[model samples]
Target chain A: MIRFFTNVWNNFKEYIVLVILILASLIILSQNKSPQVQKVRAIAFGSFATFTSIISDMFSVTDLKRENQQLRERNAELMIQISKLRKYGIINEELKDLLGFKDTANVPLIPATIISRSLSMTQNMLTLNAGRKHGVLPGMPVVNDRGFIGIVHSVSEDFSIARTLNNVDLKLTVMDERSRINGIMKWTGEELVIINIPNTFDIKIGDRIVTSGISSIVPLPLPVGIVEEFRPSETSGFSYIKVKPFVDLKPIENVFIIAEVQSKQKKDLELNFYRRQSDEIR
Target chain B: MKFDKIFPFLIFFVGLLVQVTIIPLVSINGIVPDLILIMLVYYSITRGQLYGTVLGAYYGLSVDLITGSLLGSAMLSKTLAGFIAGYFSTETKRDINISTFNFSMIVFLCSMIDTLIFSFFSAFDFNTNFVTVLFEHALLPSLYTGVVSILFIFSPFRRKRLL
Candidate 1:
């Protein structure tokens, strides 16, 4: 018995370690939402965010000049837009005062760098340098200058993780800009698909799709993608439309996290409604 | 000899660094080659299954921790792959030729197993279409990882030379 035990231990030590690690990981993952674990994770990721930031800055020295040039052009365009908006603001304010309306302002964009990307094929998440310290919270919408990129999933102190539009975890209420028809946008393993769109909706190839703003956390008309092609399901009376996302996650480095978020109560209500719909379908 | 014990971890760290910075430049359809898996293959082919499996598990755990993905999925898949690759390892370094068709075949098989298991476990259990993910996601990345394994084939470092 002693000799048999020794032989098994000698032969299967690595397997033993593998099992232990896997169990430990499962425990850790399950406890990720606990406050203590979150605090520890936050501190660790904060330090890691600093380390990765330094590395990214060191490696990105070559792109500095080109980035500077692009920034300059963007700044010039912004200046022009600011001047044009100033004229409209005066007219809008005068009308609002006449109507006794509340003042509205655009939410400021929080800029962040993509620090790391998910290594798994089935998941498409990216880590950003901005985190809770930057007021980044889970469910916040992220966008590049061109269009919507993703949603913030979790936040550490100085680092946060996001599930990109390509990930199955992300689902958006989107609209055909031209047709004004609403649909749910999600990623299949292959492509971004808007399923169950009524066949009556006049969605065509090359039509723009944007956020419907029906979701509490995100705002209206955020550019999502362009329609590629759609096909009607005769039996279901719906269309499966494929979309080409505007922001290609592969090459994106810098992105802005929109600070706009609905109140907790509102968001919770919307979430419950979604859960109910899903349960009913199931 | 002690360096052999530490070298795998060092390679794993370097693999992470290269994967994020350099591999993104050449990603095909948003799928980057798994560099650490390639290292696991190299080490497993040079050493035996036992050593390779342990190293692969550690490598996978490190990746999950750093990348902030679902933990243990990579470790489980990679450990099994390492065990499989260990059988293909020769008893002696002198008997093994790293830069050969046989080496590529071994790497290909190991990557295939790693990706298949990793994708299966990581994917959403109910919602995902298994066959679509198996083909669209796992197959291409495995092929890409196999292609990238060619770089290690002709590298200066070999187990015999290092020793």
Candidate 2:
């Protein structure tokens, strides 16, 4: 038996090793959600991101002059828009006061730069320079001036990884700005798509999509994308709406992490409501 | 011999550095060349099959951990890719494979397997069209990696070290 085992090892050693490694990989894949794996991943990326940030900074300096000029022009344009919005803001505040509405719009923003990006067809990720030290936490919404980028996935001491809108694993609840029809939006590998919209929905091409207020991940109604294609599935009686995002991940260097997740009070209220319903059924 | 054994890992780190930092700049429609896979194919062709298989696993796992992709996706894909690339590691043809255009073709083959397995694991959805997934996630990236591998054949270091 020993001799036979030795013969197998000698003849098909490569195959044996391959099978072992593949099995190990599958096992590790299964353990992705385990706390230990997440900790190790955090440490690994945290260490590597230090070097990446230096290299990224080196590249960024060359583009600074051009970016500065663009920013200056954008600042001027924004100044004009801000003045116009100020007039609306005063009227909105007076209206809110008359209606006895509470303000919940003030959320802190943590500024960070993209240190590196792992761009793939499905698992696109960005490493940012902000982390736990900067009050950036997992599930915080990352956005730029243009619009929503993604949710922060993991955070280390000095770095955090975010799954961009292009990542397949990230699904968001978004609504059509015009029709107010809510649908689940996700990256379909080829494009950003809002899936399972009923055919009777009033969504149309050129309609703007925004994060739904009902979404737990991003409770704020933030701009997401514009509907570019509306493919109605005849048999399924549903539509797949393709979206073109306002923020392009490629050229974006700096971003702001909205330092908030779904409110604990809201979550508890929802949980209690579900518990009450379950108890009533019992 | 010790230096030779460690050389591939050094190349992998440098390749990964370039991959994360420089590769994104050249990306077309979110498709970028797999510099790490190109380096893996080169080393696997020079080394034996057993060596290649083990190296591929290490490379894949490292990438997953560092790049924050799905933990085991790259590991599985790269292990198979390395095993397949090892078929051309015969002593008689190693030099020809490395120095000629065949290297690119081999890189293409390995990259296809790598990307296909990765996409299948990370992005496969029942609603998605398989052919579209294959073309966008596997074929285009492999072609880009294969085309980029051509530069390796003509590098000054190739003539200095391999020839």
Q: Could you tell me how far off, in angstroms, the CA of residue A129 lies in candidate 1 after the best superposition?
A: 2.3
Candidate 2, position A208, lDDT: 75
Question: Per-residue lDDT tens digits of candidate 1, residues B15-70?
Answer: 78777666777887778788888888877767777788788788776666667666
Model 2, position A187, has a per-residue lDDT of: 91
| Residues A1-282, model 2: lDDT tens digits | 999999999999999999999999989999999999999999999999999988888876657745764664354334324433433354567786799965554557777788899857799999999999999899999877777899999999999999999999999999876677888999988789998888999998998788887898997767888999988989999987899998888898887788889999999999999999999999
Q: Every model's Cα RMSD, please?
A: 5.3, 3.3
Q: For model 2 chain B, where is the 10-residue window of minimal lDDT?
A: B154-163
Q: Who wins the lDDT comparison?
A: 2
Error of 2 at B52 (Å): 0.9
Query: Per-residue lDDT for B131 in model 1?
Result: 78
Total backbone collisions, model 2: 0
